[model samples]
Target: CSSCKESLEDQCSSINNEDNSTINNLKEKLSLISNFQEINLEKSLTLAAEVGTALLQENDELRQQLHLTKFEKSFSELELEDQLEESSKKIEKLINEAN
Candidate 1:
């Protein structure tokens, strides 16, 4: 009976050692996972900033194009009006000379 008791004590000690090893391995895996997450987070932030800057530059370019289009349209309208006014004056002079 004393020999059986000693064997059981040794088995318990072996089981404890295995358990401690498993716990340590799990802790190391958790630390690695945490570091990986931090690295990914920084990469995500950097990409987002780059995308935001690109979008802002595109918006500014579109705004400039719009302003140029508006100016060109205004200039065209003024030219058409001037041409029409000159034609009307010439027609009035012709009618007066005929009278």
Candidate 2:
């Protein structure tokens, strides 16, 4: 009977050790998961900031291009008006000479 008690006690102790080992492994896995989540969150935030900055730069470039286009159009209109005035003066001079 004493031997049987000893055998049973040994079995219980072995089971307890296995449970402890499993618990330790689970704790390690949980810690690794927590660390990975933190890293991912940080990277996501950094990427978002970069994307936002790029968008603002693009917007500024587009605004500058628009301003330049408007200036070019206005310059072209002024050139056309000057050409028309010169042509009118030439026509008046030709009429006076013919008369």
Clashes of 1: 0
Q: Give the residue spans of candidate 2 off by over 4 A.
A: 1-39
Error of 2 at 5 (Å): 99
Candidate 2 lDDT, 1-99, residue by residue in tens:
346446555655665565556556656655665676466676567655655665565566556556655765676688799999999999999999999
Runs of candidate 1 with Cα error greater than 4 angstroms are 1-39
Each candidate: RMSD: 34.0, 34.2
The residue-by-residue lDDT of candidate 1 on 1-99, one tens digit each, is 346446555655665565556556656655666576466676567655655665565566556556655765676688799999999999999999999
Instruction: Give the lDDT of residue 93 in candidate 2.
Output: 100
Give the C-alpha lDDT of model 2: 0.64
Please list all clashing residue pairs in model 2, or write none if there are none. Answer: none
Q: Write down the lDDT of every candidate, Cα atoms only.
A: 0.64, 0.64
